[model samples]
Target: DELQAQKAAIQRETDLADESPEAQAIQEAKSEVDSNNKTSTTHIDSEKEPSAEEIAIAQTAVKAEARNHDLANPSASGEDTKSKSETETEKLAAAAKAKKDRINNNNEVASNTKNLMQEEAIKASNNSDVPNLVTNLNQSQASD
Candidate 1:
């Protein structure tokens, strides 16, 4: 433990000594690199900023190409629409199956509860004391 504490104190002193004028010069060089990076980024961003006429021309070209594309491949677009319809149909069928499964589960639960209630009622009827008591009374009278 003493050895570890001594090593830690020595490391702290070494770190403090390393933070000298030479290290400060290196840090200044790094700050200059950071500033140069910021200036370069601003230059790139300014170059990338589009003019109003260029933006308008690009927008017009995009709209015209889009119109031409729709005209050129009307059948493909129709097929895409048909495929979407089929997908919706399949989704509807899947939803119906899910609903049917839920209904079947509910029916099964209801049937099981009904059967359980009937079984309990039958058990209660069979285990009643009145019939056994009447039978015992008749047997005693007969013996007398």
Candidate 2:
């Protein structure tokens, strides 16, 4: 019974480990590598050498498969592929732009808040029956 319980515990742990994101990523990478190796290795019988036409056909098939793979995962191949330095530079630029945008947004919000508070204060001060001196003076001057 103890051995069975230990086995069950180990199996549960293994199941949990397999379900982890890191394990999943590793599995996916391994599968991709395996598939790539399988696609690249052309099987041949040692007794019979392949003809020129057969070799050409195999090469063509390999090329087609590679092209299809590139098409299916554009980031894995072609112009989208970037050097580490280039990728880091792009990331830094994006981060800087985001920070600048956030600062600008905050400044705008602060300015808006300040303007709103000033407007509210003015409205509150004008709540009395007395007319605002500056506004009345301006209106009187305009009438004159």
Candidate 3:
């Protein structure tokens, strides 16, 4: 009786081990691995060398993407279109023109100021009521 009871208990323990959480997790992992292997094998079997037409189509797609990128960012593309020396030359020309304009403007301002001062001096001379120091000095010197 004791041996039979021990045998029954061992059988129950073995059954419980098969139903354990660890055993279920291991079973699930093996199923996933098998599924993945089958999928990869089928994918490999189905794959073939691309046709020339397919290759051309892929190349066209790549070219179109590149063109779109260039269109989207024009400044970032074709950076070598203008040579460095050409850009420098243009900048120098602009700076020279600006300097020339500033000098011309200053000359114009000075000429205008000189003309205004001459007009004021003439007005003062014509008005006898306003005392003119130079004319008075000249008269006094002539009398002496």
Candidate 4:
């Protein structure tokens, strides 16, 4: 009961302090914060992707490890026929390069498309005669 009474007294003092002139400044600042939150949006940064060279190196290492493991426990090997492991590694490397090239080409195309779109947007926005052009078209249609 004593602790409850003490808490009540402390709360009353806190309420009285909040009504003071200094606390009014804090309240005004808080209002500005609330209003700013309504108008402003937070931006998130995107994650960085690995470069082509790094991806290629990692792929190469994985292919080499697989080949080494196969050679250590060869099911069949002959002079006439290159080991399946060797052939597989070559295919994987080629496939990796092709995949990388395709990705690069796609990125280039996407960048060009984005640039063209931005340029078109800029041109459209810059054309101040749009309203006049529309009005003239309307007048011509009315006459016809």
Best by lDDT: 2
Query: Runs in model 3 with CA error above 4 Å?
Result: 1-4, 42-144
Summarize candidate 2's per-residue lDDT along 33-77 as a digit string, tens digits: 999988874765578988999999999999899887776564576
Where does candidate 2 stray beyond 4 Å? 44-144
Q: Return the number of clashes found in candidate 4.
A: 0
Q: What is the alpha-carbon RMSD of candidate 2 to the true structure? A: 18.5
Best by TM-score, which number?
A: 2
List per-prediction Cα lDDT, in the order shown: 0.78, 0.83, 0.81, 0.79
lDDT of 1 at 132: 45
Writing each residue's lDDT as its tens digit, candidate 3 over 40-140 gives 85555455888899899999998899887775665675764788899999999999999878766798876876677774334335555845556554666
Clashing pairs in 2: none
lDDT of 4 by residue, 31-63 (tens): 999998877645333576778998999999988
How close to the true structure is residue 124 of candidate 4, measured as C-alpha lDDT? 38
TM-score of each: 0.26, 0.31, 0.28, 0.27
Q: Using alpha carbons, what is the TM-score of model 1?
A: 0.26
- Candidate 1: pairs in clash: none
* TM accuracy, model 4: 0.27
